[model samples]
Target: MPSADGGTTSLPPIPLALGGDDPCTAASKRTAERASWAQKSLSLPHAWKLSQGEGITVAVVGTGVSVDAPALEGRVTAVGDAGDDCVGHGTFIAGLIAAAQSKGTDFQGVAPAARVLGVRGTDERGTASVGLIAAGIRTAVDRGAQVVSVASALTTGKEELTGAVRYATKRDVLVVAPVAPDGETRPTDAPVDTYWPASAPGVLSVAGVAANGTVLRSADGAGEADLAAPGGAVVGIGPRGAGHFIAAGSSAATAFTAGAAALVRAYNPDLTAAETAKRLISSGPPTGDAARLDPYAAISVVTDGTRSPASAPEESKPLKLPVMSSTLQDRAMVVAGGMAMLVLLVAAAAVVIPRGRARGWRRP
Candidate 1:
């Protein structure tokens, strides 16, 4: 078991794969007792006052989602055997998007009330292919998903994935995906470049960022991203237990953006898919190449499908104070006392001098 904060109770890291031919991810035995940094950074409670993504359905197109995950109970509808998450990655991603608050932990999804639809974009072992992901996109759209979160990012499959995105676009469904695969799945020698589906015209390609607001090094060469969200050291639920597992990558960031999209759709039911995307992008605080995802601003800020001043990155002005050394303070106090004495003398002179002038003629 993996240890965290020098404690044995913390959950182990979720495996992307076993690292061999036909590799599969293993199940985690422990659960994290605390909430993730992403949860605190998002401040979802403020956003929830306006919308909890109550009526929206976000599809998790990945290895699969566990039907019995405690936080996601009664909210997941799986397509075929997609309900069984052997790798646990899909369940983690789904938890980030729509898990409800539970009794034991402070962790909660971005959109707690939104529904989840599970579709397998990767095989049971977490292996992904162009055909499988493309088919999953189409299936999610067919199942009436308002927003689709794709977990896989491939260098190839431009044609098939592009077609799938176009199909979703025409049907007015928003698609969110990572700019590249997570560090675990990406090969060390792979060049940083645009990946398919994310490179497609209508998809919202998201990049991962650490708590410090820097883009994850794993996503450095993945080209420009449409937006950035917290993905590093993220915590979420496993396939079967209430325990939380930690993972990182652009896929986790994509889940956050997808949940924001759901919140936008839920609050502004009349906005088109493109408009909703515009709101998310426009409302975010621009951080270099990609805007940082701000779920509250996405729903609360007023915009005309364009960047608003409320969402612009505020220039950080330094707080300035007067130099007050001990020497200067003492001098200031002396000067103030001198000025007070002068005023008192002037008042005395004004009264005495006038009386003396009047008495000069009387000698009284």
Candidate 2:
């Protein structure tokens, strides 16, 4: 079985568990309580007040999603045998995208009202080729998916996958792909190279960001990361019978971005795929690596014409975003202190230069 992104295509490496046996060994740990943290971090609650990604369909093209998961109930439309996910990666991704938290828990997904079209690109053993992933994308598009989430990365370029991405984009479907999880031990047969279709053109590549909005993986220092999202310490359902998994990786980040896209699309149904992708990158707050996804800001950009769709340049053109710099902050703070001292000197009769913690003040 060739890895989709050239490394071992087993289950997504979910090693961080809040309370469980081993890292990924825990089968039934409920993480509903932790979902609020991620939601609040992304401001999903406020974004949902505007749109819960209603009337939008996101095709999760990865490991199959288990439809029977309690959090995902009534939110998934499995295409074929997608209801069964042995690796639980697909289900986890789907839960992030569209899990309905009707269970009165904090586990509400980014786009709880959105519909998830689960497409099983990988087999039971969590193995898939780039061609299979491409097929899954096309299938999701054919099934009326407005957004297509490609969870796997491919080491080698495949024309089929490229064509599939092009096909979806042509029809106004946003294609979101995450860089494959870094630091996982690659199989000896796996290729040592950058992952694709994330590296492919026309795909919205996302980098994983920790809760503090920092790029989680140091290797994401490449040009492929178009945007960043909260992927670290994410909580989502695994298979139906199994409990939740507190996972962290680029895959989770990609799902959150995809869910944001669904919300943007639902808010402005007429925006093209290029427009949506551009809005996400242009509206987000820039970190050192990439823009941290701001769902509310993106929606506001669309609704308020911060950058009108017509004014946006061609998709191939470069986007200039403001860099968040600590040096600039320090300089601003120093300038502010000097201004405050000047104001104090002007208000008082004399300049006060007391020092040494007021141990002794020399008379001038």
Candidate 3:
């Protein structure tokens, strides 16, 4: 990956989770100073002038977030043992949402001034279940989180997780989640299917896209994605260290969309959770698959409160060509010009053919 200073370097990859018997991910000893391609694509510096996510609380529900992470110090609140991140995935997600800007690095969270609430959705080893993730959502709502970023995307537990999402919606809390789990977190042969909480109504389902605006993966079979954000080859801070880590998948995109939600909420304090989600979806530019998150536009664009067609995937219509009308005289002139050109070509060929044969077809 390239740093903000236009230098290239390698960094450790952060795993989304570990198997029950697998060891926890180690803390990264390397730091990447370059602004990740995601940061550049997001145009965060321009959006910062409008809103930095002040007075907002975003809950990260996953492998716990380490309170000691330098960029998130003094701004993170945890539920139970949620402050300890063994896999470093949750901390990395939290950093994407609200890590404060530090010296010597251009990398910063979408909402740098927002507060982070860490809620453990998985066990110490990062193994997650539907029940645990559902509980985490309800807990985050109880903790007064205005925006919840769910990192777990289970194929089952639709009934249970849908209820959890409804609970958050009733409280005016916006829930953002990945449409599918990261590739490494699920079985390689697993079929693409709906993930709970994200498939639930009123929840903002997000997919991941590379820096080039190409989707890294498709949304689950449930339905169309609400939005896409930078998730491929993304860089962020890890737990218990000043070093940075790289990760890719819709979970990271969900964190970014959650941060953008915070920005919208902070900027438009009167908007409801649904309204905030609508604002984000409406403001984003459609990329055929899903709307691409544009933080600056989400904050700056004024809407008439009506949903745009881009807010959801619609049945694509076939392109229709316009009806053409031409005068008979004009058509006749076009025909005459074609005939004149054809006659000139034939006359030239007739003059050249005999000369070429006489020269035994050799170049003159």
In candidate 3, the residue pairs with backbone N, CA or C atoms under 3 Å apart (3 or more residues apart, or in different chains) clash, namely: 3-34, 4-34, 4-35
Q: Can you tell me which runs of candidate 1 are displaced by over 4 Å? A: 1-9, 18-29, 184-190, 305-364
Query: Model 1 reaches what TM-score against the true structure?
Result: 0.80
- For each candidate, the alpha-carbon lDDT, in order, equals 0.85, 0.73, 0.85
Expressed as tens digits, the lDDT of each residue in 243-279 for candidate 1 is 7788888999999989999999999999888778878
Candidate 1 local Cα displacement, residue 143, angstroms: 0.4
Q: Which stretches of candidate 2 lie above 4 Å from their native place?
A: 1-29, 102-104, 182-193, 303-364
User: Would you list the rank order by lDDT, best first?
Assistant: 3, 1, 2
Best of the two (1, 2) by lDDT: 1
Span of 10 residues, lowest total lDDT, candidate 1: 307-316
Pairwise lDDT winner, candidates 1 and 3: 3
Across 238-344, the per-residue lDDT of candidate 2 in tens digits comes to: 76543555667787889999999999999988888888888888888777757788998888764233332213323444669988699998998999999999888
> Against the true structure, candidate 2 has what lDDT?
0.73
Q: Rank by TM-score, highest first.
A: 3, 1, 2
The sequence of per-residue lDDT tens digits that candidate 3 reaches over residues 162-229 is 99999999999999999877763444466656777788888898888776777665443434678889
TM-score of each predicted structure versus truth: 0.80, 0.73, 0.81
